[model samples]
Target: MESVKIQNRDMAWHIAANIQFPPNFDAAMTWATIIAVHPFGSCKEQTSGNVYGKALAEQGFVVIAYDASFQGESGGEPRWIEDPTQRVEDISHVIDYAVTLPYVDADRIGVIGICGGGGYVLNATLTEKRIKAVVAITPVNIGRLFREGFSNYDPLGALAAMAAQRTKEARGGELQVNELLPASPGAAKVAGLTERDVFEATDYYKTPRGQQPGGWTRMLFSHAQNTLGWDAFAFAEILMTQPMMVVIGQKVGAFGAYRDGMEIYGRSTASKDRQLVSLEDWSHYDLYDKPEPVDLALEKLAPFFKKHLNEATGQ
Candidate 1:
């Protein structure tokens, strides 16, 4: 449970990170680094990633959990804005730091993304070579979210609306802010999430269980949204040469999450190492520490990292 400050290039932005390893870790396993990303607008401390990281550390690896850019202790302006591009960059930056640790094998570094961060790590793996393995838990393909709503309508329309808003802000040096999430559960949210989303998010964000005031994000970013058309990989097209692990829950309709993951899994050239684990009664939010659902994902996650980190994999 050791925490430290990791400074980013801009604004001397320093992310608060925790790295934990087993009490009697063996050096023979090679140094393994786990860079964990939390859901949008949430900090590293308030995530399923933290608990999961500790779990992995108990198996003998240094797990690095940190605040995503502009959230928690991390630095940025008009905070809590979703910037898909920057999010990927943040993943690379964390790996950059991971390799610097003396115990880090450099060749054995991997990543884990929770919620939106899951989607971010999926995209991040495409260009980064240092990262050898990846895990996306209940990832959100923001591109799809903006192009079509829960009903699978034109989610991109929402992103366009935000883009238009940014255009106005760019020229005028001013902006009209909007709510971070939907007004409330309604007929609009595609996943029938209006009610459940408001209700649960209120519990996580408003209550001490996961509350952190600075964790709130803006309705839009100052940059482009990772929509399918312009995305590095549309929901289905991005390919990777690295080993990736995809986990999706089954409690609800998970078409989009699994759709995006399978799309990548099919395109990835990596052989004999890709895995897709499905939980029987899991939902998208369940991977974030929902009681019954997390058990399934958690059950598989530790062993996945342990097998790769401790066993003979990359040599």
Candidate 2:
């Protein structure tokens, strides 16, 4: 594993990334590479990204996981803002860096994304044909989440809140921030969050389990403005030509995300192949780091990438 800095075009920002090479890697050998995109409000070292990156590397794939722009170690101003367009572009920028590596096979690149990162992966693959395959675990469509509540309830209220926040931002008001997870376990219960959603996130991101100094639970309210009109599934029918896989927890409480995944799969007419795997016992966050669900997801991902990215035979 090596830590490297990649500069985006125009040199406006530097992306801090960790590239993991398989054991006994040789510079002269061309190897398939996988770029892992972290979830919302999380960094390269976040539990899910770290776990998946290492696991995929051990499976003989060179994997690179990096913090998105404006968050974690990546360079940007107005920290913690989650702009959908920039996030999608970040994946391509990472690919831009990966293709330059001596050992990377530029023709055989794949991508994996968890949580909100998954949706961005789908969006990026719409136009980035260099990505041969894509895997999304417990994906969330931020645009749909902004337009419709997590559970698709009280959409009017959600829209009104986003409008109010946008108006305030236009007036040069102080940036409002909101927590991605409950501040305390009790707060989750008060907000009607499921037990799995509450404890899993708090334990992984806010406690000693997998916490990192740069990991944050807060994001700028202005993110809603960018996500409000962005649909990750847009152009799926015509542009998502790569092989795609979606691994979702059946019991994921955020129904809007699950619905969005289904829509993406349904509309992806250009995919060479498409798959949707539902883990009956898993929840949204469980696939983030839990051994059982993560292992199960990897079971599917390893073969999917191997089949699609292997250069021996065109997939």
Which candidate wins on TM-score?
Answer: 2
**Cα lDDT listed for each candidate:** 0.67, 0.83
Model 2: ten consecutive residues of lowest lDDT:
150-159
In angstroms, give how far residue 302 of model 2 lies from its true place: 0.2
Give candidate 1 regions above 4 Å deviation.
Answer: 8-12, 25-30, 150-160, 171-174, 182-199, 221-238, 253-255, 269-271, 312-315
In model 2, the runs with Cα more than 4 Å from the true position are 150-173, 190-192, 195-199, 312-315
How would you encode candidate 1's per-residue C-alpha lDDT over 1-315 as one tens digit per residue?
A: 777887756535766677777677665655677888887667776664456676667766688888767667777666665667877888777777777777788877778887677888888887887777788887767666555553247545655766787888889867565445533333235545544444555456655666665556444444545443335354333346667788876544433565665556666655337788877666666567665666677677767876665454543
Per-model TM-score on C-alpha atoms: 0.81, 0.90
